[model samples]
Target: MHPLVRWFHQLGSPPYFDRFAARWAPWCHGIGAVTMAVALWLALFRIPADYQQGDAFRILYVHVPMAWMSMAVYLGMAIYAAIALVWRIKLAEILAMACAPIGALYTAVTLATGSIWGKPMWGTWWDWDPRLTTELLLLFLYLGVIGLYAAIEDRRQAARAAGFLAVVGVVLLPIIKFSVTWWNSLHQGSTISLTGPSHMDASMQLPLWLMVIGTHVWFVGALLARARADNLRREAGKAWIAETA
Candidate 1:
């Protein structure tokens, strides 16, 4: 086999992954902390207010990143779930299950911050905008996965059932992402794109990028922490677990 495939196999080993998670979780957290703090400072203090939206626009620093992560995490969870179902990788199952609560948290944050921003910008606390409605549905999907997993008695069986739900829910992700384009909506078009010029000025853009990157780094740290706990619970009968304990 190729060296890359060998490396992947090695990384998939539970014990190896546990050690890797232990070693890197703290580093990711540390980096996430520093970046988020710097990003907040830049967003709140340095970036000028939008001439049109004024100070209300600063909320984008929080809302956009959380919204982006909500979708990204769901996609990631579905991929992990697929791997668990197809390859029967225990780590994939753990990771997929772990993703539920975190994704839900991001979804909740997105909704809350979006609402807060909306009241000022749109003069209403809520609107059934296409993007907002789909985002709310995304939250329900996350919660459904969590509820289904908790309702099952056996961990492995629960993961399988929840994985199926997660895979099915992947359909919601595209709907959430494309709602702005597919329908008339209060939500503005995306401000940043990798393939196109950003609508934001450089000052505002840098901090938003920093926050986005930091949010992802923080998410990995959170996932590793949750996955580690899951590893312990699932592997309680294994000798390596006792040794690590």
Candidate 2:
């Protein structure tokens, strides 16, 4: 078998995963912190103000990354949920459930920052724009998954039920992504594109990309930490738990 496949198989073991998470989570967190700090420094002091919005545009450095994370994390959660549902992988269930709160957090930040940014740009704190509305629905879906997981008495069953909801909610992602294009919305169109040149200047774009990369790495650390804790709780009284302790 391939080394990668073997490593993945080993990762499936609760004790092995616990050790792996413990060893790597801190490193990921440290890297995320350093990257975010550099990004913030560049965004605050080094980059030029927007020609139109001025310093207010700096919020995009935070807002855009969180907005991206909100959708990206949900997509990841849904994939983990699908795997858990089909394969009954306990680690997948833990990961899917762990992702809910983090995704919800990113969604909340996106909305809050968007509101702050919008007030100056659109002259309103909130609007039922297509992008905003679908994003709100996405938040609700995240909360619903979290609530459902907590409502059931049995942990595995709760995970499965919540995972099912997560899988069903995958439809929201595309709608959120294309909302501005599909409707006459106040929100702006995409500025950055992987396949083409970005609309923003290179200097302004650099920090935003740094923040995006930092946040994703931070997310992995957070996810692994949360999953490790949940795994320990679920495995209470097991031989490995005792051994680990």
Candidate 3:
């Protein structure tokens, strides 16, 4: 087998995964922390206030990253769910289930920060804008998966059920992405673009990118840590757990 394939197969083992997560999770957390700290400092102190929104625009650094992660994590969870359902990969199931709480957290943060940013700009803390509404739906989907997973006594069965919900919830992602364009939204359109020129000045864009990168890295660490704990619980009383303990 190819080295990469071999490594992947080895990673499917609960014990091996436990060791791998333990070894890597801390590094991811540390890197994410340092990067986010620098990003926050630059966003808060170094970057000049927006000509239009003034200092209130600084919240975008926090809001945008979490908003991006909320969707990204959901997509990731759905993919993992599909893999687990098709192949019955226990690790994939664990990973899919593990993603729920983290995704929900990011989604909640997105909503909260968006509300905070909106209070000054839109003169309201809440709105029924298409973008905001769909994002709120995404949070509910996450909670549904988490709640469904916990409701069942059988871990594997619960994962499969919740995983199915996650898979089905993917339809909401694009709607959320395109809501501003598709509807007359109170929220602003996306300013940053991957392929095209961004609308914001380069100086302001720098910390936003840093925050995005940091949050993604931090999410991986959090996912692995959560999955590791779930893996241990599922594997309790097994020979590997005994030896590892």
lDDT of 1 at 53: 95
Candidate 2 residue 82 Cα shift, in angstroms, is 0.4
Q: Looking at candidate 1, what is the lDDT of residue 122?
A: 92
Candidate 1 off by > 4 Å: none
Each model's TM-score, in the order given? 0.97, 0.98, 0.99
What would the per-residue lDDT of candidate 2 be over residues 84-139, giving only the tens digit for each residue? 99999999999999999999999999999999999999999999999999999999
Clashes in model 1: which pairs? none
Sorted on lDDT, best first, the list reads 3, 2, 1
Candidate models: Cα lDDT each: 0.93, 0.95, 0.96
Q: If both were scored by lDDT, which would come out higher, candidate 1 or candidate 2?
A: 2
Measured on C-alpha atoms, candidate 2 has an lDDT of 0.95
Candidate 2: clashing pairs of residues: none
**Which portions of model 3 show Cα errors greater than 4 Å?**
none
Candidate 3, after superposition: displacement of residue 24 in Å? 0.7
Q: Cα lDDT for residue 98, model 1?
A: 93
